[model samples]
Target chain A: MGLLLTEDEKMLQESAAGFFADKAPVSQIRALRDDRDATGYSKELWLEMSEMGFTGVLVDAENGGFDMGFMAAGLIAEQMGKNLSASPFLSSSVLAATALKMAGDKQAAKLLPEIVSGKMVMALAVDEGGKHNPDAIQMTASPSGNGFKLNGKKSMVVDGHMADQIIVVAQTDDGLTLFVVPTDAKGLDTERTIMVDSRNAARMVFEDVEVTGEQVLGEVGKGADILNTVLNAGRAVLAAEMLGAASQVFQTTNDYLKERKQFGKIIGEFQALQHRMAHLYCELELARTSVLTALTALDKNPKSAGPFVSMAKAKLGSVAKLAALESVQLHGGMGMTDELDIGLYLKRIRVAQELLGDADYHIAQITK
Target chain B: MSDLEQFRAETCAWLGANCPEEMRTPMKRETDGCWGGRNWVFQSEAQKLWLERMAAKGWTAPSWPKQYGGAGLSRAEDKILKQEMKRINARPPLLSFGIWMLGPALLKFGTEAQKMRFLPEICRGEIRWCQGYSEPNAGSDLASLATKCEDKGDHFLVNGSKVWTSYADEADWIFCLVRTDNTGKKHHGISFILFDMETEGVSTKPIKLISGRSPFCETFFENVKVPKENLVGERDKGWTIAKYLLTHEREMIGDSGNLKPVAQMVAELGIIPDAALQAKITELTIDEWAFSQTMSRMLAEAKAGASLGAKSSMLKYYGTELNKRRYEVMMDAAGYDGLEWESERSNDGELARLWLRTKGNSIEGGTSEIQLNIIAKHILELPGT
Candidate 1:
């Protein structure tokens, strides 16, 4: 009923949605999913998207980025949702940029320009096993002379292989610290563990990773705190994208309902189905508002992410699942089959459910 | 200077100087929260005086022009006024459908005479108005109303029943949409008419809900003659006026920033709620703030004569859902309190009553379902039957 987006946001959404609709469609995703490399997105699409400013969405314009912040990144993710675009918009653009911004690192200045310019890619290898809580890190780093030696592996790293650098979260005696490691660094072994969507995976394995003191992303033993903040920002943007996926699927389901006749009338005409679609539509809109609020709240720092992401993850994670499940269930067997893109949306939603954390994890965070 | 700053300064200073301690707690009828207290009368003399005083100055209807019985405040000024009032938790001076619903319609569609006659009473809070639109069969499919409005040339006969009328038993007047032409399409052939509830054959039977207190009523019209002069707009054009009023209804559903869901939330989640929950509560409170800000912004846009079509649905959806969330929080907090279904508990901690009342929000003012249909079809370009 309203264009909750700003005028600039509207323009940004249009341009972004247009880019994904034209540049990244379902067939390309299907091909990527089936390939041995499981390369979800190609370099060409990445470069083209970089030209459109998808990579450095939150980066300042002078740094070859959009400077549009989390909202713009979210707009891109939303468009990506429509195409199930397997890109590093979430990992490199949003999560990585937030990390650099939080670290007060102008080095991201030298690095982000290349990343924003699509010449380099970065992924925050933040997630560890058992629970997705950043504070629950088991990975370790030790003081070795003037620099730190890292002996830890971050699994479920998005675009882990495609990244030029993986920001590793490690625990130190001092506290938690984040260190940037080159993808081809001596001790780093990247075996892309396949995801259901194939294009995205858990890049697992670690050796004695040596890095200079200068390689530390932030204060020693404080990376967990920093990563938590970054993920909250990521979660907000993730919600917007979740909303985009839900919205598109709702439209798809609505179209299917109208076109597919049943019980002597189009299914859309049935009050029962109409109410269900409408309910899903409400859920999507709720998620949309909640995400927007969280995006606006991200700069509040420590107090910000703790509550905002909890709300986002709890609401969006569950809401996205509902929308995805409803989209498929309401579509009948065709939605379940690989014949349509609906099933792919569901798989990706599953990945998002695990992206930052799941429903239970977020609920626990909020409760805690 | 920002109108908000000026307005807040002015309002605070005035209240500080003029607000009486007795008026601060505007005496309200004590009752179970669901069915608002009828036995309890407002005790604050300052409230009555301020309301009357504000009505004379047209300040209560802050955005309306002084020419049409309002304070003629700018959008920013209105925000400041509301914020200042909220800062004091000032009891609402005017609370009735007349202020929220009918005034907007009269401003839009009423004749000069109609405005002169009705608007002032609305401002003075002398007359209470209720809506009569829903029919037994036409609850959601409202256009299929069977309310007959046959023209007698001098007057129109309004004979039918409107169910689920909010406070109709207490209303002085009702604005109704009745089928004026049976031959036309179902959506067409309707005329908008206003009539006095005290008129012959006009009666109300209050429906006692599961919650105990009866808020809604079954309003029936038996050969009630509404003067042709009382017809709003043209004949068979009640649908237009009715649709216009529905926007106000939907907007009302959305704009509840004054109501705090925090207390209810605390009551619902149990465990007295620690700092973490407080932090979450703060986030929710901020969301409510943002939502209200957006509503005020939309109000400004509308005042500036910008077309704000489906945005009303946006407001309604958020408002109603927030309300539901408030109830959920309450129920959660109540834990055992919410589960008590005894008739005796209906007035007390009364979880059953609260739950019953919560169900009413979704059903009224076009169910959440209908609101979505409007949004999807109009806002998102989704197909609807």
Candidate 2:
């Protein structure tokens, strides 16, 4: 995502782009519209992605990962967004893997290989029902049998129902803590919910779900630090994905304007529309710069990644929202139909704009 | 050692030895800038020493060929020289419109004799130049300029006025666009010519701006005769040269948007209490940083000789917009205290005047609207209506 990419990064981007283009194209996503699958993605395609080592993109080499940095992960995310690929790349590979890595030895040694081999799926349960506050862990983690018992609810958990294990952010007597509770653990319940974007999420209710001492990630009550690190990386990758979606949709709309005629000429001939498209390109390019900067900054120092990551998310969120609106408006009636790919981008972007904190949330975060 | 690093070390040594302490301080006002011309005098002995030392080493115009009184450093080395200069906070030795605008045109389009005659003086800061492109009647529609020049065999007799000529009264020479054969399209028959500001029938009237001081003038050229040798390129074909020169001009204006980070201002202002203002500053800081990174990338691209083409218009619009936003924030940060005028405590209301001056940044190098139109037409390849 830097101005100049290394040959390895370039190759990764190209191969990932090609793979998504062939395997998880928009048509493949559209097929999931009526799919009864609980995961909201293709298992075969996810397996193919794991074969490509995408699942281990952020994990350490000792844990069977490529040991590539956040920028490399961003490259994959961008490509997936371009294809409108429905997968757990973010929920599992990016968010959960980052959490485990930041959680350090004990947790990663046990769970990461299973994730790398595509045998396990992990979902991070951080945001509660209210606003997107990374530190607002209302879920209680009480001491129980030398471990902890979690009791609360997590809403809009991406790929939560399909998660083999969930990293739950909850408050303890000391402060915030993370407990990696098995989805099948007693007193835990997950209800599948279909989002407006046609992806499946879960509202997880934890009724005194007990976790062992070994299940507590990192130092107890230090989950806030771990959550911040994971989410910053997550938000940056999310911004990259949103950029790819916005860029592709912008390109699609521009091409449509050139071809679609109104009155007596191609719609793109209108100076009014041309200016609008030009402005959109500017926003998109600047947003791209923000993404690259966030990725690069996070790679260097995770602690300082908050502001840069928030900038990228806020800027790209606004840009992607603009792209969605303009793409729909520019495409006219066709954009409203589900058959068209433009609406799909709009739906996905509308969802992405909210995930990992929306523009307004991040603007407030950095502003505060 | 890599060639550039070695050159960088040598440049650092030379600049350390030459750049005066007085020159190393941040330029606090417009007068601190060394705009070299006939009327220009060194404000201090240190200023004179610094310029003389740099110009002697042919570094005033680093990348210009050695024959043109330049160091003839490669682009990479030229960048290193800039880095070295900034490392020590070195003020630019010579600032001239001649070096930035007309010199490139002359090197590319002028006769060999013209290059030999004019470039050295420009590089050495002996002759300062002001542009004479925009007339009172032609602004955004610049090609419609009707500044007529009559062909008189031995000379071209010009009779017209140029508006918004920055520092024209103090500039030594003017590179002007004159109407030579306005018999065809509006753009046709335009000739680019050069002449001294002290020529007969030449005069300038300063135009007062909202900034309280006049840096621009209305330059009048009535029956001023310029030698046939002073004409750049071919007569009636100067429009090409004019367009080429505008690219450089736009680029210069676009770069003006790279202001220092707002954190420095916040530091100067002490603790800011308003959360909204703090947020705005943070956002602006990030944007400024990103914009600078974009500029660096563009510069690298330019060094590789890849034409930015109409993308310069994009840069121009964004850069000016950024500059305007910067001043707006600074004024806001100053609160009501920034509204003072001609007071020593407020440094003659410098910040307030600067905020007003930024209004012209967008308008001068083609308005933001015009740049957007250019981007839409050329960069976006949208059909013209």
Candidate 3:
């Protein structure tokens, strides 16, 4: 429980890393930004990932899944982050799959196959506008005949415009509830929210968006329980990705420090800069261990996943942010340019810091 | 069913039968356990008996060879014994730098005669050891030490001083590094040697630390003679052994940071209602837990024969940082009472003193900055000018 990674797990990580390195590189990430790709990622690479069994990693084997745990998905996310591959893997393959599987309802059965096959993109519309506090949820689901009518906006809905289905968290008479709504449903408005990271998300305004009784995820008034669990999974995956990004950023900066000569010598020769890089390296190791421990904790005790996830998020978010800042600062003028890939990591890290929950938000949740 | 299980059961049975009830409770003060040596005094007969019983069974150095008065258990079996002891809440039978730091080096590099001579005494708690690596001018740059040792054919004349030698005034022997040849590279011309603390001209002066305790000393060797046979490995090759032993020293220092839960500390301090303090406690606790997991992962990797190399620097740096945070939060939880000095209400300011003591944890066993340099050069492979 405390030690070595089994051979199977190691192989799973190796294959994913190899796949990302071969199929998705930083050049491809830059191309997407330069072309202003509407989807913000490649559909062909998504299918290849699905074919590699990554999309179904968390689903039951009976439902076209390999049944690998969140740790496996975390490994995939880590590799994808190294290449800065932008995709719905986090939104659809990880968070959505976790929500559906944890719910274990009829909708999961109906949608699991499509989601696993990469035919359907999914996003979770949970927060209203403020920070990622679950208690700030005020989107209402009012009674309208046989189903509920959804109103209020959900901001920063990751991959919302590209999604065919969106799981919206709304307040109803039964308290917080989750509903699976079709993206193109009546009175639904989706505005593409261009982010600093050049990633795709949408601000969704749900005006009388109707859903049937069967669309409800889990029991009424109990969506918070499922939402928390899904959010823990999201946080863990995010931590893994951040670790990868921080590690890459550290390596990139180290290379720059070695190559960039200043005053007739390499900048890496400077003791102050070396010490700073070393500090960042230690922080990266801490974040790495915290992320792995969080993933293991989730598998060991699903009920007690909150503190571990929060801890991982709090530590990794801070580390990733520091790594991004330090990497940019270490790379000097070249790092400030958009043409350099290091800026891309910095922007992505900044956005990811605020996603799921920022470090401060998570510290509040766990500490208080 | 398994051999380890059988060993665990036997260990449990023996400990239950032998460990005194008073010794089963938590150590309330630093002086609760026996640090065996010539100057050692047992806190109680139970403490003395406990060390005697454990030493008789050669469990003091459980993983050492049986011929050296050790149990000769495998690493897994040794771990089981530790778990069994912890399950019973049994206090450690003994703690000594001899057993922790020097024993491993001796086992690896000592001649057969030297191992037979020194290790059994360490196992039976008959001798105590102190390190002589750091000098005033050579704390982080330890190889630049000016402890000069001249070749006198059968013996060497040692003349120099070592600063920050913990418990040097009470030690039975000193494992020292001295400059054997100043003509070569600072690292190359050094040698590791051992000598009795009672040797003529050897003297110690205790240095009061910020904690107001004199646990460390300034040890001077004025033409003290150490036998040539006491020289470890080859002459002028002690830097390798010094670095090897430093890895263990760093590990030993880091491993002492197993504090109780922060909630338990709050309960003890009687401040369960303050949200600000609670938040600090929670944050520090999470970091400690993460650090523990990392340490365990590293331990497992070490057990699998994977060398940690420069990663030990990472462990030392983070472990000390976490330890400092632990005490800081404890002080914060203790409030005004934590700041009391030399008062009965504050255990004579024990908490405050210990909190200041942790500042030394980063400085000793190589400063955190030195560790960072090692990490940068070795682990991260950052090139130098």
Candidate 1 — which residues are off by over 4 angstroms? A1-4, A60-66, A105-110, A299-306, B22-42, B135-138, B144-153, B156-161, B220-225, B262-325, B335-352, B368-385
Candidate number of the best TM-score: 3
Q: What is the TM-score of chain B alone in each candidate?
A: 0.86, 0.97, 0.97
Candidate 3 per-residue lDDT, tens place, A1-368, comes to: 63467788899989988999899888887888789988989999999989999999888987888888978888888998888888899899888988899889889999999989999999999988767877898899998888899999998899998899999999999899999999999999999987888888999998988888889988888998888889999989988888888889889899888888889988898889999998888777768788888888888876798898999999988899999999889888988998788999998888888999998888788866
User: How well is each residue in B3-38 modelled by candidate 1, as lDDT tens digits?
Assistant: 566667777898666555554553333231111122
lDDT of each: 0.75, 0.86, 0.87
Which is the better candidate, 1 or 3, if ranked by TM-score?
A: 3
State in Å the error of residue B108, model 1. 1.8
lDDT per residue as tens, model 2, A1-368: 36667789899999999999999998887888866555689999989999999999998988888878899999999998898999998999999999999887677888998788888999999888755777666899999989888999998888997888898899999998888888999999899888887787889999989888888898887888888889998899989999899999998988898798889998898877887888887777778788888998999999988888998898888889999999999899999997799988988998888998998788778776
Docking class of 3: medium
For model 2, give the interface RMSD: 1.9
Candidate topping DockQ: 3
DockQ of each: 0.22, 0.58, 0.67
> RMSD to the native, candidate 3?
1.7
- True-contact fraction per candidate equals 0.17, 0.53, 0.76
